[model samples]
Target: MSVRAHIIHAVTTSVSVKLMRGQLAYLRSKGVDLTVLSSPGEELVAVATQEGVSYKEIAMQREISPIRDLISLCRLIVFFAQKKPLLTNVGTPKAGFLCGIAAWMTRVPNRIYTLRGLRLETSTGLKRAILLLTEKIACAVAHKVICVSPSLQARAVSEGLVPLQKTIVLAGGSSNGVDTSRFATANIEKHTDLLQRHNIPPDAQVIGFVGRLTKDKGIVELVEAYQALKNEFPHVYLLLVGNYENGDPIPDEVKTVIKRDTGIILSGFVRDVVPYYTIMDVFVIPSYREGFCNVAIEAAAAGKPVITTNATGAVDTVLDGVTGYIVPVKSSEETRKAIRTLLCNPELGKEMGQAGRRRALNEFASPVIWDALYQLYGELINRR
Candidate 1:
């Protein structure tokens, strides 16, 4: 039998695909067996199938479901046992923890838990404790722990979540780098029809946000800032590309209010986000926290300026006042100022956007990240 590896996760959103896309292609090129296991609701199954990679759906909920959790855990244990994968890789917090637990129980040869951001960062009280415990459990189970960001890796060790000796962070800590060649400004030519179909005019200044629409993502703050600046900038437009699941942290009232606003256009979720980036004059991620702001990098790679919070992963992506401004999280005043500054100064935006593209090519290119993962996989397999 060929050597098989399993990449497990919850919702296989754009992010899941972005992080694993290059790695999957590389694995296939090497004739390594690649199987992705994710929650039942994801579009990953279909996409992976088309790529000739296998997928298995497991019971998963974005939020806690006590009874269902038990059933899911049992099913995962059996699946791991049956597959006996040469390697087991888990992602996202809940999925990481559950898969880590199952991998440990089955004594999988090479177990990896790739921790992105701590979901517990924004939690409180007893709930926070539970989240922390789960993280520890997941870290303990993995033979090797993967922390996507240096800041997060430091936090993990300091917080007593993962041992210093067992964890590794690769290439400045993005889950994976952007496909620079694909996201280039030239590629936008292919997306001309996408813009027409979306009813977006050729000349509108599209300010876009891509991620789960939630409180933690600072959707409310984004709206307030956009509301404050819209009337002043007549050609300005807002595009929101994401879904609003019940499991999301955003308050119902906030979601209702934002969706009803005529100024903002919700595209729900699109498969190929490269076109959207091409149409956008500026890409904004006013998120309160992030593992690594891949969108900011992608935006920069697409030759669009970015505005994000001065938080963990974001700081690495943006060059303050150069590539874009890094403002205080949850502060509408700062968010608006940054956005307006970019709009009023198009040349600066273009310059910064160009700088970001160079930076991405040097530091966050797909090959740079793929080589790192390929080497890591080789090391782990060799050790076994």
Candidate 2:
């Protein structure tokens, strides 16, 4: 087991490059030969160039399509057999299941499944069963399962998806910890034009969110909460940094409300989120589920306090009353209350934001997580 051994990392979509970029580069710098695989897209090309790693595009659909899945599975088996990687780490639901089975079939010595989040958490009936079954099979085939948060690992074990012995959380649980330097307040002035483009007043108190605008992300409740906050605080503004996703969409009524509101600024799917974070006075991620809310810590790294729901991985990103408030999942009233609390007491919010910055630097720095991952890979390779 040498650093020269081939290692393949697979994800369902190119968007996952945001999470794996730092780790891939870190491993490559350590002299490990790495190959990245995902569905073809501009993100895939960008990540490959950014990390200086070899990449292969494999078609993968996020939704269930039996015929397409079968074809993808067969293709993966052939690809795995050809590459014969010494280690294969697969992530996201589709890639995890397909690549896990393919790696096992090809007798790849070290197979790892990175369980970011469990879709079964929000799904119901037949969909829940299928998601759970896929998770079980993915875990069964992998030599190890790396959960991004302690709570996620606990839930998976409790649900019998993976045995506790095979699962572990690395370095306080984040896929790639925040780049503190990149997300700092020093970069705020560079993006002031972003405020002008969105027509957001310079002095407005901005409450921001940076994720897919979907039901699972608690977008409906967030809108309701925002509306309530607007009535109370005229200077308050909502800055949503992501786009509406087709899968698990937010209700049309919610979208209508967002469109009707002048105070809510939607910057759909921006490539660089740092500047958007700078414009935010307070960050909110009212997600109903998460595997570790990366955006919360990124906001924290940007010197902004966060208000997130007390859902599994979401809870781990903020220190309840210290870094910011934690409201119950789907509770717009509580979310509104937390937002009001931060808004009324700007001093308190500033104190919390400063605390959050310290916490992000101490607990979730990118280098720390990358070093832990590099060591984990070395240990797994030696064991194999």
Top candidate when judged by lDDT against the true structure? 2
Tell me the spans in candidate 2 whose CA falls farther than 4 Å from its real position. Answer: 1-3, 189-191
- State the lDDT of candidate 2 residue by residue for 1-384, as single tens digits: 365878999999998866787788888989989999998888988988999999999899999999999999999999999999999989999999998999999999999999999999999999999999999999999989999999899999999999999998889888788887786556754367888999988888999999999999989988899998887888899999999988999889899989989998888988889888888888999999999999998888888889999898999998989999999999999999999999999899989989998999999999988888778888999977
Every candidate's lDDT:
0.78, 0.90
Q: How do the residues 1-384 of candidate 1 rate in per-residue lDDT, one tens digit apiece?
A: 124445443332333654677667766676677787777645676557656777788866656788877888899899989988878878887788787888889988888888888877777898889999989998998988888777778778988998899999877667667888787556854366756776767777778899888788888888888888878987788889888766546777777767687658888887778887877888899887778888888888888889998776666788887888889988989899988988898898889988887887888887787778767887888778
Candidate of highest TM-score: 2
lDDT of 1: 0.78
Where is the poorest 10-residue window by lDDT in model 2? Answer: 183-192
